[model samples]
Target: MEKYVPEKDERAPSAADTTALPTSSNERTPSMILEDLSDSGRPATEEEIKTLRHVTDQIPLRVWLVAIIAAAERFTYWSTQVTWQNYIQYRPDDEIPGILGLGQATAVTVNNAFNVVVYLLPLIIGPIADGKLGRYRTLQICTAFYLAGTCILLGCSTTPAVEAGAALPGFVVALCLTSIGLGGVQTVTTPLIADQYDETVAKIAYRKNGERVVIDRDMTIHYVYSIYYWMANAASLGMILTSLLEKYISFWGAYTLTTGVLLLSVFILWFGKPYFVLCAPSGTVIPRAFRVLWIATTSKFKLDAALPEKQLECGHEVPWDARFVKDIGSGLMAVKVCLAWPILRLCVGITSSNSIAQAGQMQTGGVPNDLLMASNAIALVLIGLVVENGLYPFLEKHRIPFREMARIATGLFFMAVSMAYGMIVQALIYKAPPCYNFPLECQGSDGRIITEPNHINVLVQLPLYILVAVSEVFAFVTGSAYAYKKAPPNMKSVLQSFYASMSGVGYLLAVALGPASKNPGLVVLWGSVTGVMGLTAMDNGQTRKDPVWHGPFAHDVPNSISAFMSQYSALSLIRGLTSRTCTYELKGVNFAYLPLARPHAVENSQPSQKALSPGLSDPASDNVHDRPSGTLDIPEGYISTGNYIPNHNIVPTSALR
Candidate 1:
């Protein structure tokens, strides 16, 4: 067995080379030959570059698999939710209100509770996936849980012997399981994509990555969040069909159908596993340190690390200075201010004023109300896509900053208009008599129940969707992007959860306020007030925090403070807020969710001296012993090195000294 050594001048043999030499001891030593090859300088040619580019163009198959799985999971989630209330509310006329209310209440509670888990899971799952099971396996485990939950729901729906109460528990359990799955999927898949490809490749492949490189995990997760939400809605579109199918078939049939889709997702993920690069989990040291630091500041716990060593000045490390803690406290105060301002405005302008107005409209047929509610979802889907992919691009091209405050301002304005639209519809409904003498209702020959006509009321409220849509485009999308960009790298997943948490807070507020006001006029009035406050905040250059005093005592506080703070903070934050620059830049960059099309040209053309062949001999050395040995040993009739010398083709001594 001869030792083999790589040579520098091994000039990659051309296709024309076709001769092989028998191994002999007299040949130059492989080490000497390797030394010669190391000294030889050769630049890569055009062909190599082209070959490299070709390889780089093909994205790994794993990305598509992950995407497909994500899409399927979303579809199943949405399909169930859209009609779950309707399905559960089915009852006789007498039991309708109680059953419907109970179902709605249960669903809402479950949604909120599940969200807590969903939000918190990322905090732990990110570190776990990065350190323990690896991304693919973790996703697989979560998928299994999701599938199990679907099966449980299917069984409960199918078993006639099971009481509704009993079945309800099963449904809750299933929801919990599915929520875990959702969290796991949310935590792992997006980060995995970011890990596999470089910045350039990601940009060309994923629309989100085109403008940014080295994005915070949060930003990457935002794209996943949007995609996941859309998938859920897309699945919901199947609800009508599922409901009809339940009428004709069985409830289990619908669930089973969804399960099948989930299984297909699992299959895709399994097959594509080979293409993903599993990132090793970060050790316990960094994460534990973060946890300690967070606790120390938030709970006033003492730090475990030594004072001098613990104080990290580099923005990347955990800051341990007492001032840093103060800054954090100030930041929290700012957030409190931000959260309170909007609520106060909404309470005064909309909730307090519109209670009776909303009640009056509710007295009319509920079709218009349903339409108004439905319009938000419709607008979210259409307008979100349009603004994110279409409008934002156009704006970016024209150099619009698309700042967070600008978006929040725009969204609040539209939201106010939406409330106003509702108010106008309410007024029309109020003017119409309970039994309008429109001959159209009584003209029917069949003795059918005649309901009040409120066509005018419904028709006028359609523009509310436009307002909601436009607001969502600015508030939700931009807010999400901003959150992810600003979040620290280690906290990417947690940061994404924070974005979800904000929306959760918004939903909670909506639910809380639903019963607070009984007049529609008041609601519209409060909405207008909030809209103005938002606008004032933007104009004054206030950051996210600018408190809006709420509560019964809110009237005591002068608007002057709110106005002054909003203007001053806006200017100060806009001028001095260097912290957000990185985030803003991230929003500009593009990221690819899928793998690169192929291996990059640069990677492939950069010669690995190991791959080259050894030359016949050195030209400068008259001493024959110093001559290089290895030669292009292509056998006659072979395009490549197809077994010219059995298992041991090139003698090790021939390629090196």
Candidate 2:
């Protein structure tokens, strides 16, 4: 203490105030301080940066392990599905009717219905995982169900004298179990990736501070999804070989092989649990609000008083907490907005196109259709990589606003064109002989072949895949991004389910068209309808202000003030009629007269100047009122008032103000 040289002036240090610090005879500061600052200020060397990146960028090893498990699971599922109908038809000595077509159509229909549950369960399962079971544990339970289903399927195949009647029930049970398990797997895997890079610094570090990082999660998800597809193909290829082997080998051999693969998938997921970051479910406010909104929309009560105050799970008041209610209501409201346009008529056309495609595939036996299906998956994998890594970066660098809605519209147009091309191909193929011989060999009691050649019907349908692929580049990838961005964070699973539902709707339309196509004129009529719809979609896409709803009721009148008012005014002026006949008669009269009004308002109005301005600002007075209005002036050269800014030449706002 006695030897201290006034302790370096005993004050807080400053950049310019180092006067009391000890210095060498040359007047330089100590080397240690200089070195410390130099170390802090200098950019990291290449080797140092690389090392940092390696440590930070690591994805939990478990993700890769889970990916493998998922791939294997998909392999087992598709392997069974690809050959299921054929297996059922070939079962020993069974004289099944020409119902193979009916069976295939039924399978697709049943699959569509099952998908609603498959998709909807994730909503409930996600919470159960977060609240009751952990992610890893939930995976374990689901894996067991998947394994059990496979085992049951194998057992059912072995059962002697398994009549078609008995096999149906067994197959349905196995499908449901497998679907439920896979649904759980999907729900759990998505959240696991999110947990791995939950920290902001970790996300940034993993992204290497690059734009590519934003898509890193999706790339990883899809990469894992692609691996599953590849495994599925491998399994399918093996099954085809097995089908050939059936001439020399027992059916048990093929069943045993599939069972072994499924078991291995189970083992892989079980052992690799330790490396994953098992995230505890955090209480999310958004989900609570969503529940309230869902109830409001689906229930019979009014929006404000939809749920009783006592029943409101979210602590906040009903209307206040329901932010999504407005968005969803607005989206529904926008349905009417679409109905006013001629484009609304296009839904019928689009529905018809989807139906014809479906019915055509079914009638031709779904093999060519399956090949076309493969193209969509292939396109999805390629486009996801290209757009994420190539096109997006180019656009961003050039300051282009590649709006999500525009991307979706572009995709839909491609899809529409694909449908048209498919119809053209079908027209050509209608002149060729049927490709498959089995259908022609089966004869009716009159000794006439039950199925006759319709032409090279299957081959011409191949182009539909290319069209599907192009449409997917715009639809699937862009829609995935849009939904993920627009959906409330907690509703990711719900959004995925919603996306899957679109396919269900497509299938339903196909089923409906199958019966309708018995009349030859109906097929032509439907094609024309779809063509017009496609053209309308193209026109609306180019000129419309808002994105068009592509869902089931896309062309329906919105349930809004104008629609209600129109209906109310159209009602008969007669006083109360107590008789049931009178009420029925009145209902019939109302339907005949009341045409629901379409919404004319583009969107909800914004706050006017009077509402936004703080104090009175009279233009009549010469004195300029300088009250704190908080109203920002519209900067020169800016045209629109939305959140996004347009790219145009404009003076700096600071300079003008």
- Backbone steric clashes in candidate 1, count: 65
What does candidate 2's lDDT look like per residue over 1-657, in tens digits?
000111221222234422354456765344333332322212344333322221212344565566566656655654555445345333343232211234433443444445445555666676666556766777788878877777776666654514444455666677788777877776665545444443332121212111111113333343333333333334434444433333235444555667787787677766766666665554443455566556655554334433346346556454443354444434333222222123221232232233333324334543322233444345455655566557655543432334444455555566666656655654554434442323334466787765453445454555565565555564444444444434444444444444444444444444443344332333364466457546544443221122221211122222222221232110111111111011101101110100112212111222344433332354552111222223222221122222211121222222234
Q: Which stretches of candidate 1 lie over 4 Å from their true place?
A: 1-64, 88-117, 120-127, 159-165, 189-197, 200-236, 243-254, 284-378, 403-405, 408-462, 507-657
| Clash count for each candidate, listed in order shown | 65, 4
Scored by lDDT, model 2 comes in at 0.43
* Candidate 1, 1-657: lDDT as tens digits: 011122334422212221232246775443333333321123334333222211112333454456667668765765554445434433313211112234333433444445456645766665666556766787889888889888888777765624455567777788788878877876766555444433332211111111111122233344444554454444445554454444456566678778888888788777766666665554433344455446554533433231333445322355344443433333232232334333423432232123222322334344312223344446667766766557655543432334455555565556556656655655565456543323113334466644334334444555754665565555555454444444334444444444444434444454454443332233444444456545544453442222221111112111112222333333333332222211111111111111112322111122233432343134562211232333222211112211112112222221233
> For model 1, how big is the CA root-mean-square deviation?
20.7
lDDT of 2 at 494: 44
Best by lDDT: 1
Worst lDDT 10-window in candidate 1: 584-593
Q: For residue 123, what is the lDDT in candidate 1?
A: 61
TM-score of each: 0.53, 0.56
